[model samples]
Target: MLQDTTSSAPLRSLLFHLSDVELLTRSARQIVEEEAPPCYTLLIFTNGTGRLYIDNQPFLFSPDHCYLLSPGTSLQIENGTDTVVCFYRITFTVIQARDQQQVLYTEDIFPNRYELRVYPLSRLIRLTEQLYAGRLGKGDMEWFKQHLHFQELIGFLLEHNLHSDPSLSLTQSVENTIHYLNHNFMDSITVKQLVQLANVPHWQYTSIFQELTGKKPLDYLTELRINRSKEWLAISNAPLRDIAHRVGFADEYYFNRRFRQTTGVTPRQYAISMRQRVLVKDWTGHEVHIPLQPLRIIYYGETIGDLVTLGIHPIGGNIPNPENRLYKDPTTIIHDVGFPFNTERASALEPDLIIFANSDERQYEQISKIAPTITYNSWATLEERMHILGDWFGKKREAEQWLVHHHNKTKTMWQQLQSSINAGETASVFTYDHGERLFVMGVTGFSTALYHPLGFRPVSKIQDILDAGQGYKEIQESSLPQYAGDRIFMLLPENKISRRAAEDMMNSTLWQSLPAVQSGHVYMAEEAKWNFGDAFTRDKLLEMLPELLQGF
Candidate 1:
């Protein structure tokens, strides 16, 4: 009988040739008894009853049965049959088999190997014969033999063990949900709606949805709408209001608000501005053959001046009644000094005279080389800028009259709204991003242009924060003013993170506790319009403010 090896000792092996067939069985029994090497022993029982005991637990084996004993496990065998048990045994040290790195023995080799039967007596006998023949002969290469044996063994096991089990009903349910969302994405959809469509409880459906496709259902739907909207915005010339309605927004205002919130500019502005940068229209129609003299004029930024050159009308200037005054002769080719005035690009596009409004003297120095560049720092003050432009173009007198007319018209509109505003009513301007971060815009920021011009004052604390230069930072760094005010205007972010952050803030206890939140005075501005900072954006705010403020 083989004696037991010490538990603490490392395994050792001795190479011995199989000389006698009868002695092989006897040696196997000794090896089983000793459990000395603490390695695998392949045993095949061809006749008579046999039993293998592991860790003192008996596992009965028949003539057709085979047992693979794991290393480090103790085993004892007993033969109950009167006839000598005919068996074949192989004891090998598992010192890094060559086929170990092959896919044949990888973790996924058997899908459910633990529950399946493998290594029957007949199969084990064949494998042992192959192993014995390969080991005993010098003709067979060790690597090839190992590879063939391992491949055959894995193939046999996998063919019997690996089977797929997927529920058809579950797959169909997911398909239906995806189809419904794709067909009706523009319509307002909620989690509850998806759960209903999937015909599963909300909690169960959420898990299945994520497990199947790795995204929340609503998030996926929102992305679809946003993507589709982008395509329509870029290629289609439909009115924004029509596009908004077609995309399932109940009103153009809300659609504009959401589009801007998502894309940072209004749909019209994004289309027009981006198109202007790349679009070069062929000169068509009868060229009003005017003597094309080089006219010196400076404008802001390279692209801005370039765009203006493309659209400049020769018939209009600061001339009084210019809208009615038509010039039969085309004027000189207008020369641009370049935009933003101070850039290297502007320096390259040298001009005889520089025309810039609302920029500082620093911007004027670069163009001073070409000619005396006029600086108009107060251009941001709409009235002042209009006058400056009018004067520079030899239409100062005409521009003053136009300014007076529009100023009166705007003032009247402001007075009308003010007359209706309830006493002590307050307002605040704030912007939000997709990440849910709120930015408080001061009275001076472009956001407050509509309200501030109309004699509406921001709440004291809001103004103080704005005055302290605290509101212009990115949303994460800025804080929401404590004053609740009667009304709050918020600009939203275009990206998903900013949107989620803004939504999180809206649902937070801190936000709910604020007076605006409590009174439902919060209003979201159209993101597209908010981003443009153009005439259309200004017009939208003007139209929206009175109604929004009235509710507060």
Candidate 2:
């Protein structure tokens, strides 16, 4: 594997047989006189802009944009104001042709669109580092493997860039609807309500939606309800009647019958079975351990209370008013065992297992001594964390299966809703915070798993920001105009101060002038469950879509 010695972080090198590689950074003062060789080059623009005359056509590049250059293309670079260009160049041999001409890697031409495919670039960077490390060996089989990887890299870039698919836009809209429905499903909603919210006509919406997604609206909704019921049953000790009502099932008997029809078991039976699976089983027999001998696990750092609430309640562990236990429980059990470094108290807990709710490596090492420990990394997105947790508890297979089941259910419901509305309509997810930030969840960060799976496209500018690695950043008051779209999800802040701040922000001259606000397309997401990313969060996003996208 080659290594990029210039970089501080360890990067995996490319497995390909590259003859030469160079990484260069040039400022505006430097003369842009040279043309790139007939080889592959990746140009990353971090804090500057420039223009290149490629095949005699002038094209722009900037910090907000990047480009990949191909062989046999004539090029000339011209610097922009205060511009800087950072680029990587790679020279590699392809199998020679009979005519003695050097064979190129792939014949695919780059697209004209600005959506730079970052995945390939990321891979290339890794591969380059590996190559720099002097790990590439000389062998026939190794050479053949490298050739295959190179071919794959070329193919990926071609498909992502040159061969464009317009269907992605429609698919994105459907996804958006799914995301909305998942997050807001607790409310009373219907297909008619969805058609109205989406602002599309009924017939056109239905056909395209079904064509793309493959299910009717009502069926999807019922599936979502059933799936939500499953989560509630597994995680919460709340009465079945209350759970049914919360999920929009009007009658308990109807909810029970539907749940059984979908899952092949009564809610209580399903809950009990899940609990049984979690209990420690003896090796010789299938006998379950007694409650007094339950698996002894200790939690460390902040958010221990949150995790306990999430885990125990659904698993049939009852401690009436566990929130108050934060005060009454042993300080050893729920201490402020600071994160990323603290480990003394956690190690002394001396339990079978430990969970560090916070992402702290030092604490992780300390707890590892006492027992098997799982430390969650906060930098990862919510879905990433869920997958980690699933693996930690030996439930990856079950978790994946559950995800697939809910995904299918949401897909069916989205298709049904679309069948009842017009095509080309749009929607948004809205929530208000205590700071009155008017946070709009987009297609990355906490909302990526929910939104991407559902097929929603962020409004153009918002999508652009997300693409630029600006997902989860604060939306500027002046930039609100660019986000006006066919639908709006208005989230209100939870606390009084946050609410006041949100009200002030909304009342601002700039915010009130937006098209969405004027047209009454905004729907306030005030539910507490809708605020976070979890199974419940997925439900709320779906439920709200029908209401948010109702009339197009």
Candidate 3:
């Protein structure tokens, strides 16, 4: 394992040498065996009951336990449950510092052999989930951020069990004083007050505190107060005097001086600059001045799919069908702002950014008052939407990485399917509603993969329809023979009206005469899977395409 010289955090550098991280689920009565692990394994369970045996000693395990499996330790686990047990398992090799071998010595952290430490999973579970989901480690910078989080987790464990390590005995006292300053930062706190609270001599306490945090005690307090004030300045329109008083400054004039010293700007200038909105020309061409890094977003558009792919579950948003598998939970997790977008409900959520697609222009004025509103063209290219959103969320690198990953997946699937399908075979996608609604796969959405290089080609007739700029043209059943390709995908409609219309087409004599139907090449595509084209659905199509192309 190599040292992480990229990061300044020591614990982060320690975790940079990770071997693997994964989420595992065990069924009821499942028995698992173990050999001596090659690396340290950290198992964080968020649910279910289980038992682990180490050296034939049984340890009762349940939710919120962070178990540490040291190297060369063997264990067995059994889930004694009627329900499934899910846990996140992380395996990493700890690199010992050549000069500071005493720091994070395996023996010092674990204390007992094969010790299964218990830790609270409040924030750790989300971090582990993010790491396992491919949402956190997309690039070098993203991985560094994740390393910092891992460092925080290690620091948390050390904070909880410092009694076992004598080398960090003074860290315990400094941590106590730090906790006091954090809570009392808004109060008139002093260096003497914190030293008195730590029950240590002024000089000794100052030295140890500086050694741990790399800042003087009063400097730390001042930094904390200024940081808190910055948040208020960004989010609130409160007066300077009130904001200054709230963050422990008795006088507005003194706060102005300190804020300028720390931030290189006057407090008033900082507030104005911090809350300054960023302007973006949306697909609708309307300039939207959106707040930076909006924590509360309301998505009222074609799909919430992009937000999810970017790992942002907006505070409130319009949801797709409850049965839409692409969206993890349309009913439970997302607060539904009704389709026509209940303006009152959206306002109630108090979103910092409101994004929608093709909404009535009349509603923009009202919606803008609730928050900075931006509109997107639902039919625009996926790359276009992703670029706009990546800029909005400051995830431009992740967005680009996903595009590259998606492109590779599409290319790979194309190669795999080519081996199973006829050369130059054409495919057409459409749905039967009141009538035949024929769609030509474009460069975006489902079309990106369907018509990607070496993928399926559209029939000459449908190609003309696409060339004519009518995205999805509605043609009669009589024209099926001319437009239907060698292979076809018929998206099943969800509404009863459309289902009945589709049934009529399925029974029509003209439909059976089509080459795809006659040759058994017409497949019923899942609506939830094919309807909206987002990154998640596109990735899923990669997995499903090869199997669907088999024997065709």
Give me the displacement of residue 325 in model 2, in angstroms. Answer: 18
Better candidate by TM-score, 1 or 3:
3
Better of 2 and 3 by TM-score: 3
Compared with the true structure, what per-residue lDDT tens digits does model 1 show for residues 1-552? 111121311112212222211113322123246453344445555443444665565444444344444445566766543323445555544332343341111121222111123445235444444444344223346446544664464345344334422232344355446655654677877889777655666787787777866888866665566555654665458887777766666777876777687778887886655332111111122112211121334444211211132232321112111111111111222222223233454444333334444344454455455544444442144454455445344456665665576557667767778765545667766656535456666533444454445555667766675566453434343245455467666655545576567666666777777787777667664342343332223433454455555632
Q: Which tens-of-lDDT digit does each residue in 12-104 have in candidate 3?
A: 335335667765667667988867676777877655555677646555455555667777667788875443566777877676565645333
Least well predicted 10-residue stretch by lDDT in candidate 3: 1-10
Clashing pairs in 3: none
TM-score, cand. 3 vs. native: 0.51
Query: Which prediction has the highest lDDT against the true structure?
Result: 3
TM-score for candidate 2:
0.36
State the lDDT at 405 in candidate 2: 66
Candidates' lDDT values, in order? Answer: 0.46, 0.50, 0.66
Query: Residue 340, candidate 2: how far off, in angstroms?
Result: 12
Off by over 4 Å in 1: 1-298, 301-372, 378-380, 415-420, 432-438, 443-447, 450-455, 465-478, 495-500, 531-540, 547-552
lDDT of 2 by residue, 1-552 (tens): 001112211112222245554445565545475675666554544333355666666444433234555555566667643324555444553333435454445321343322234343434443433232222324677555455555554445445544345443333334335444554567788877766544445785576567755867666778878876765675468898999998989989999999889889999998777554334322222233222212345654322333332342211111211212122111012222333334554444334445544445564455566544555443344455555555545656755665676577678767767654445545555445536565556543234433443345567766765576543556655666666566555555436677566667667887677777887656554433244444434543555455445521
TM-score of each: 0.34, 0.36, 0.51
Q: Please rank every candidate by TM-score, starting with the best.
A: 3, 2, 1
